[model samples]
Target: MMDGGRGQVNVALEVLADLNINIPVCGMVKDDKHKTRGLIYDNIEVPIKSGSQCMHLVTRIQDEVHRFAITYHRTLRDKRTLYSILEEIPKIGEKRRRELLKKFGSIENIKNATYEELLATPAMDGKAAQSIIEYFKQTSEA
Candidate 1:
């Protein structure tokens, strides 16, 4: 969820940059303990300093993205779910899925992660890592 949050912040920032949504943009940051801090504005992070600003921007973004998600983004995540890492080979069943999740933790970690790190997991192999790369490519296309 934190990774997703970071991505959302980045997307909002990019939208502001590209479309010139000049509302003062801030990022909701999490501390090392994984606690919700405040926000970062213009590279200077202020913990919960601009929660209202961040909330307003996020709400606006959700409204806009919800409007467009089905039309554009769905086409991508939908197409790729079939070829996704854990779902790629039929041989990888429920047990393997649980094991993978237990080992790697989350999808974002598995995605940004290197093949070597993946292979280092107990019982995970090169073939699984390759499948992960294939899934990553699909998601990136989205």
Candidate 2:
């Protein structure tokens, strides 16, 4: 995922959602165990329970998405230096913010995006998208 980042993960989620792919996404989320954990999407997290019957289901899914987005069984090891001005915003973090930038292409374009447009990106809820739009407008005026 985009240089082993969550933003790329969210992008994958959106692409799947748009394509109407109905599988749950599971991946290595760095928490206490340092083991394979569930991914976060749309502000909610779908976790993978280990050593359970659900584990098999989760593993099957993780394997499938991996084959689709990536080559074989490996994760994205490196990332290119692709970014926009919006990604520089504070409190945005690497996941949701970069997703917004990539989806909108630029701050100007994102400012042009309606609330529904902003919400199209994964993890961007109504409030966050509106706040981002407001920031874009404020910065444009200043």
Candidate 3:
């Protein structure tokens, strides 16, 4: 059972079909008020009794799915934001950015690192290390 409505269910069905997996897929649909209303399978709506155990379970599942999706998206967004910051450094491309991240774990660590520490990172050169140091310095100043 999916936590979303027709759109999500259809997309999931299509993906499963592509993988040669045939299984019944149903969606726990919400009403206009954003409350779970019923299940939808093959465009048929099966109304769920409000305040019933079934309804409560569906609500729990939907809440958990939404929470998980939000967390995953936030993590991806943070990674992208960090990588873009690294991209701003003149001599830091994908490889050097990756190396810096691997060595320091976070941008805060990289920014706090000394020039020698940055240069010691694998795939990092003196120019790239200097670029990172200068970039962080400028950003901090602004």
Candidate 4:
């Protein structure tokens, strides 16, 4: 299933077909009034009656999926922002960032961690730990 306008739904279907995912795709789209219009299947718009059980189910599903997608995107954005700071430090790539996040849970915890504690994290070395320490110190000072 999908959620978007006609163009978006069509493109998604095409991409799914390209990936060899053989499944029927339907879109939960909204009308000009910002209301749940209905399911768009096989390039046809199937309008659902307002206040019907089917409408309630479709609206609930669409609302839930939208909320989930937004939350997921926000998390990725926050992680990117946090990891971008780490990227500036030498020897800190995707693997090291992941390791640090796994160990400390958040950038604030990593910042507050001691040099020795940083080194104790999996895949961390003395030099990387020192760099992290210095990065936080420099930022805090500035």
Leading candidate by TM-score: 3
- The lDDT leader among the candidates is 3
TM-score of each: 0.36, 0.36, 0.82, 0.74
Candidate 1 structure quality by residue, lDDT tens digits, 13-123: 787789867675555576687544555666665554435775566556656766786778776785356336567543465565666667767666767878798777666
Whole-model lDDT per candidate: 0.64, 0.64, 0.91, 0.88
Error of 2 at 18 (Å): 44
Alpha carbon lDDT of residue 96, candidate 3?
88
Q: Report the CA-based lDDT of candidate 1 relative to the real structure.
A: 0.64
lDDT of 4 by residue, 80-113 (tens): 8988888898878888999999999999999999
Candidate 2 least-lDDT 10 residues: 72-81
lDDT score at residue 138, model 3, on the 0-100 scale: 95
**Residue 29 miss distance in model 4 (angstroms):** 4.8
Q: Candidate 3 residues 72-119, lDDT tens each?
A: 999999999999888888988899888888889999999999999998
Q: Report the CA-based lDDT of candidate 2 relative to the real structure.
A: 0.64
Ten contiguous residues with the weakest lDDT in model 1:
1-10
Candidate 3 yields a Cα-based lDDT of: 0.91
lDDT of 3 at 17: 100
Off by more than 4 A, model 2: 1-84, 87-91
State the lDDT of candidate 2 residue by residue for 1-142, as single tens digits: 2222366667777889999997655334546655556655554556767777765765676678767777632333322223445555544557886787678765567778898988889878777877777777788799
Better of 2 and 3 by lDDT: 3
